[model samples]
Target: MNTTKAQILDGKALAKKIQSDLQQKIATLEPNIGRPPGLAVLMVGDNPASAVYVRNKEKACSRVGIASVGKHFSAQVTQEELTAEIHRLNENDRVDGILVQLPLPDGLDSVALLHEIDPQKDADGLHPVNLGHLVRSETGLRSCTPAGVMKLLAEYNIALSGKKAVVVGRSILVGKPITLMLLEANATVTIAHSRTQDLTAVCRQADILVAAVGKPEMITPDMVKPGAVVIDVGINRVTDSDGKSRLVGDVAYDAVAEVASYITPVPGGIGPMTVAMLLSNTVLSYQEKMTI
Candidate 1:
């Protein structure tokens, strides 16, 4: 008897489909709306990875006919100044969505600045008001990464209802929101983290396993249930032999792919979907504003 290997969840292809749909939607909306939806990106300092992410987001906006406005600030910008800029964007009629790139300089308070953005324009969906709406199961924009994960699962026709789902990590950005979204879909969800006892046993019970623990190669084959769906959300960079750096996911993909029924690959899986969802949210925000 031969065992079947897991199917790869191709996020890039799915994201392209979503982006194309959004482009068509924008075309229909332009005449009534007078112009394309606009997204304002506020990037602080010059973190290499953050720069890449912001650039990709802008490019996505351009592809979908959304106007992109970028405000790049120096590392030394003050918290008060950042808040003032957020207020300015919030008041701009042309700006439909606002995103402040994360990891501000050492002294800046990210959480405080998050609160300053008008919830209607919070493109990243990190504001307390939007998060509270999500907690209450009300309609509001969702965090891009978690929203993207749900979109990926739905695209593959994976039913979350009645499944035993486990999310490893409880970060506000990814883990907590995804767990809630799964629960909203009627999946029994468990959130585990670094301090979880008998973590392997807990993970092995999951029908759908999500690894967002931010550590490389943490979810091995031993921790997975055979035929479970594995979603790898951690993108860790490591130096291979000969000092070459490469991106690797939290799940040991090569080993876990042998046991799991389906898996998402690093770089190509969850990453692209995030930017796609952000564009979706921006368009949705713009449409919502028009109706109000």
Candidate 2:
């Protein structure tokens, strides 16, 4: 057991360090910027998960001295209203970042709404322009979760160049962007999705493996290669046989940790890192706007 246990990549610690650095940078720049960096999070309805996430973001902004210009709209709010709000925020001098909280309402078109936000002010970094910049290897705001994964990997000095990296799941959010990032770092990247054949064989070949498929504890120990660096980015809530509920990632933490050289915990891993990257992106936008 002792021999099998892997080193823990403490994302929470790295996130704290990132936030502290951002706070210091904000303090130093706020004097010249003339106003605090502002992030506008627009939530259309009361999604419990989204509410929790928004609250955490607001609290993080407060800690970093950024202004939270949050807007909570009724579930019945129309698409045109949300688009107008995004336009207003795009033109607002005080707001550096704007993001529409995910899973907006049943009738809402999330992709359209995301497109409405100006790419320069897109805090989540999911806009087509930013994604295009990523594909072209140009500097641009990046999707928070994938950026967090890259940051975590960097914090531990994990070498990505020339390594075989496999990303399970091909979603634009975490999987696709992270694959591109790994490729940019010169790692040979393979992205596997639900339809992929021989998934276990594919995953075992990776020196660096990232799981972001949103399934709870789906990647077992057998799927992992010994001495591989494992980054789990899935956050899922599951109830135990005893009816106790808790969060878990796509990789089976305890089992996979034994086989992998490094591992990240469920709740304390990518979740905090995602929030940290959001703050970083906001600050970056703020700096860009102030200088221009």
Candidate 3:
């Protein structure tokens, strides 16, 4: 008997469908609510990657009929100024969601600014209060990347209940939150980091493995369990033989795909889903406001 290759989890197609569904919901809410859901994005400095991400988010908001307001501050902007801006957005009636792009300029405190945003308007779901809600298993906004990953899993009908899951990486933005989400779904979760010994052995035990270590090709075929579902969350740029740069994931897709039962491709996998979930968060924030 011969074995078949794993199925590919197409995030692009799912993201497209999600955007279309959001557009219809936004259209319905606009007339009755008297205004579209508005998202305020605060970007500091000019990191090229950050610029691309912010632009993509703006385009996603436009596609779903949500109004996006962007505020670009200089690298020299003071912490006081940044916190003040967040406070302003918190009080703005029209701003349904607020997102502060990560990796602020040197000397600026990202955590302090994140704490200043009203939890209700925290579109990125990184605020301590919102994260606390997730940790407590309460109903509230979740980090976009983790939410997107879970959405992808649910779409494929991957059963998480009572499964063994290994998440490589412990970052607040992706790893820790994802582990929590998996646990919420009844999966026994293990979070591995740079300090973990025998990481490969731990990963091989997972029924569902998530690679988010941010190192290109760090999770190879040897780390994967036969028939395990693999989700790649790392997006790193590397120079090709021609000296041109390209994006790749934490997992070695070619090698891992040969063994895994299912896999998400880089660029098209977690990337688009992140944007889709952000739009979903905006709509959810609006709905929450209406109920109050």
Candidate 4:
């Protein structure tokens, strides 16, 4: 029996290199622009996970010499109030990127707020204009998570052209955007969701399998094709049978790693890549401003 383990897709290492490059790029650009690139991350409520994510983003911005104008608000902040804040940031000359963290407090409309951000400054790349550009395959900012996934694949020189790609989620956050991106690369893509029939069979058909279903260890060995490359985008916290709390992806890592040719580990995989792409987006926006 051939038992060669899959080569690990080391996103953490790639993210570090990306940051280093971005930092050097910023160092050269700052003197010309008269100000460093600024990214404004507007965070509401106090969700612990969101808090940690926001903190990490600000720290990364600092390391790359980008200014962090992060705003914190209570869970009870009104929708009108949030919209006004977004508008203020839109007009701020120094701020090149604006992102409202996900999973906002109940009764708030995240979709409406996202629409208010200027497309050029939409760092999360969730705004309608940016997404439309993605559909048309035009030049524009793309969603951070999906952009990160594509970058990691490129870094590893994974061949997507004419390959069968399967994305196991339908959210705008990862699945839909990623499917479009894969198609752009000439990958015949299928989007499998919670309601899909014969999910395992669909997943097995993929040459490049992407899991972003937000379920812990949902993708198993049986669902993966032998010699396939797997990208795990879901990050879920769960207590194992031993009662230990840990972070795990949608793929059952250990078992599936044995079956696939390449796989990305949870925590170290999509997470940092997503942040790196966010910073990259900010820098791109800043550079575009110089030309305009």
lDDT of each: 0.94, 0.93, 0.92, 0.95
TM-score of each: 0.98, 0.98, 0.98, 0.98
Worst 10 residues of 4 by lDDT: 1-10
Position 61, candidate 2: lDDT:
95
What is candidate 3's CA lDDT for residue 80?
95
Clash pairs for candidate 3: none
Candidate 2: 10-residue stretch with minimal lDDT: 1-10
lDDT of candidate 2 over 18-122, digit per residue (tens): 999999999999999888999999988888999999999999999999999999999999999999999999999999999898888889899999998889999
| Candidate 1 displacement at residue 178 in angstroms | 0.7
Cα lDDT tens digits, model 3, 28-85, are 8788788999999999999999999999999989988999999999899999999999
Cα lDDT of model 4 by residue, 141-259, tens digit? 99999999999999999999999999999999999999999999999999999899999999999999999989999999999999999999999999979999999999999999999
lDDT of 1 by residue, 104-170 (tens): 8799999999999999998999899999999999999999999999999999999999999999999
Candidate 3 wrongly placed segments (more than 4 Å): none
| Cand. 4 TM to true fold | 0.98
Model 2 segments beyond 4 Å from truth? none
